[model samples]
Target: MFDVAPTELLLVAVVALLVIGPKDLPRAMHFVGKWVGKARGVARQFRSGMDTMIREAELAEMEKQWAAENERIMREHPPAPSLSAPEAESADGADMHDLPPLMVAQPDIRPEPVAAEAPVSEVEEPKTRGQGEHPL
Candidate 1:
């Protein structure tokens, strides 16, 4: 990280040995190593956090752009004709009911056919319950 060549590093080490003394040099080196490791760990954590923040910001920007594009596209190409029937027509003596069945728009849903009901005499009816009374 310091961009110091091997010769420069050796020179620094020699200077450190003279200043710090040969006796405590190893201990000092060990302490420096620990501090460097901690610094690297903190720097790594900071970098990861910044990356996460950047990703979130990018995602938000993309979403905004997407929404704007969607709006533009919708405006450019309006929706197809509405499926609902119009409220009224101005033609004289022309009733809406007079239109042929095929000409009128039919609902997409088809109703279920009702089952044939059994004869009242053939089916036993449940007895009616009185006020607060259970039907047995």
Candidate 2:
């Protein structure tokens, strides 16, 4: 991503060594290298996790879209039983049971609660106390 060449990196390293004197130059370079490596590792791990989560989310969305599309297609072109087109009706011995497993849904049908014409309460007889029962 930096697009930095090898020559440019060497030049920068020389400048750093010159700026940081001979006594502390090696130590400073070591520390900088370690920090850079750590930063790169952390960024790589974070990007990997982000990519995995993004792919999983995309897959879930795709499945939802596919399911919606399938439902739309199923609604648009319903399975209709053909009676006069082919083998079900052309022969002299026609099979009346040859029917496709499809029919129009009853739009007027509704799930209504069934009402009973009787009361729900029932009579109960008083019970006698047991041998170990205590009276309140």
Q: TM-score of every model?
A: 0.56, 0.48
**Clash pairs, model 2 backbone:** none
Name the candidate that leads on lDDT: 1
Best by TM-score: 1
**Over 4 Å off, model 1:** 81-136
RMSD of 2: 14.6
lDDT by residue for model 2 over 47-132, one digit each (tens)? 99999999999999999999999999989998787766554552667674675666878788789899877986788877778857
| Model 1 clashes, total count | 0
Model 1: lDDT to the true structure = 0.90
Clashing pairs in 1: none
Model 2 stretches with alpha carbons more than 4 Å out: 76-136
